[model samples]
Target: MSQGSSPTRETSRTDNDGNDADDDNDSALGSDQYSTASITSSTYHYRQLGGRSYPNFRDVDHWEPVDEKQQESFDIRHHIYLMQNNQKLFNAPVQPRCVLDVGTGTGIWALDVADTFPWAEVIGIDLAPIQPPWVPPNCRFEVDDANMNWTFGDGRFNLVHIRDLVGSIRDDEKLYAHAFCSLEPGGWIEHTESFMIIFSDNNSIPEDCVYHDWNRLFDEAGEKTGKSFHLAERIESSMKTAGFRVLGSRKKKVPIGTWPKDPTLNEVGLWNQHRWMEGLDGYGRWLLKYVWSLSDVDIELFFTRTRKALRDKRIHAYELYTTVWAQKPGPGGQ
Candidate 1:
């Protein structure tokens, strides 16, 4: 879930906890669940700026030129796999009357949700206003940060969805609790996030491999900022602490490159690898600013080599964590 966007523009966030090794401080939601020391401000800013080149997530002008290109390549079917699995954890109906999408980048998920349930009102919120203006009749986009004190009424939404937001939320328990507060009784909340694990098996990558180096860079940066890089192990615990009964969870191993046997999964892997390649040098573009010992060139090289190894399929490991449909008990049900 910790990834950078294109050169012209983009936005996203989610902070990790100790269940993973590296934490990118770009989480959009800051909460009282964890200490402020969980993430660094500078690192969060870098992620918001689209890694190194762009510094703002809400840059509408940056994405204005790429709408057509995005619409063409935008594949909702690929995400259906993730969404389907995530939704399975919920006991709710196929379509809820009202839905809220947090950190809705590109409005892809929000738009798809709107299209899937025409009668449902889908409200997608993001810090960057990069979402297109041409959304479905039932879908709407709002430029807002989830971490801030919200202005919504209690028990207003029937369903709330958050995905790949590890770089945007510092405190999982508090953030989910806030989401719980805004949900109507029995409303469902779903979260999908990936953990940055070492991309290796028994022998291909040595301890000094580029993937390991990349892991170290992210780890050190996260520790320095106080954001947990290991939220993978704490998802269920966090949800339970937030007063939501857990429905189910799914864990998948996402290969770094197109090495998977399944064609569709391979395509998804390729998409991820290509994204890393295009923004190769941007991964730690600002390492020098936040990290005193590391240089920008060194950081770029780490990202580049990591990208190469991914393409080479030398490493085939990353954790895909999806927990679906936790809900608050109705009155007297708790």
Candidate 2:
């Protein structure tokens, strides 16, 4: 549990003669270019395209957009999660000794958890290098593709947390199975996601509104991409099939705008609106152009209408957010 005893790794570099170079002397080569540079350790090589940076993975990640807008939206969503959970990091009752954050965008949750539980060692894995270099000593971030094989040893984690990975994962069952196997006996795994489809309680949203059109486009695009936004709704059964015992689940109706009657929900709605507004262009840019095959001018006009609709309090549309947690059975299959 000491700092020195934490996860140790080494970067690999080859000399001009194609021989392995010593880790200590690798930096001594002044002018000679390394024939091969392999990262035996966790490393990130981000690719920039179309004014955005993307992760370098064998299979392209569903979420290819990355910029300041996405980061702001992520931070806003994190705050909203804290607000909904009353500032609790997670719903699991146990005080985990080790934690793994899957798809840790911005590493906000991992950093916060490290601060909350200073005794715990927190590891965050993501495709992008958006996390800051200055972080809590107990917390670390790795650029990894979660869809591939997990490198960590089995049963090494006490808690595994996933958030807002709706359109990123292609196979929920495989991811849950990995989580189930990676967790120690009695360890907990929690997945949080917001269903992308908007809803209304009292027929406040109209069929003619752009909100409906937005939902339809997203649904169609998700279907074509094989990363459905509706995948979060089916995670409970997937987790159960992966051998996790259901602990608890909760669903909250997050308003799309500041149109809620209750004061708390109104605040939540305002935050949610900010998140949507910041992400409006990024969300619609690629999907509309590539998936929906819309022209740039048309896409802009569509989002302009979408923005107006989101601000309309009369629409009264809300998104569904769900958090589900389950525990790996201990000895005797309890």
Best-fitting candidate, scored by lDDT: 2
Off by over 4 Å in 1: 1-94, 287-289, 331-334
Candidate 2 per-residue C-alpha lDDT over 218-260 given as tens digits, one digit per residue, 9 for 90 to 100: 7887788877778778879999999999889999888889898
**Roughly what TM-score does model 2 have, to 2 decimal places?**
0.85
Residue 332 C-alpha lDDT in model 2:
26
How much is the lDDT of residue 37 in candidate 1?
23
Give the per-residue Cα lDDT of candidate 2 at 131: 78
Count of backbone clashes, every candidate in sequence: 35, 0
The per-residue C-alpha lDDT of model 2 at residue 321 equals 89
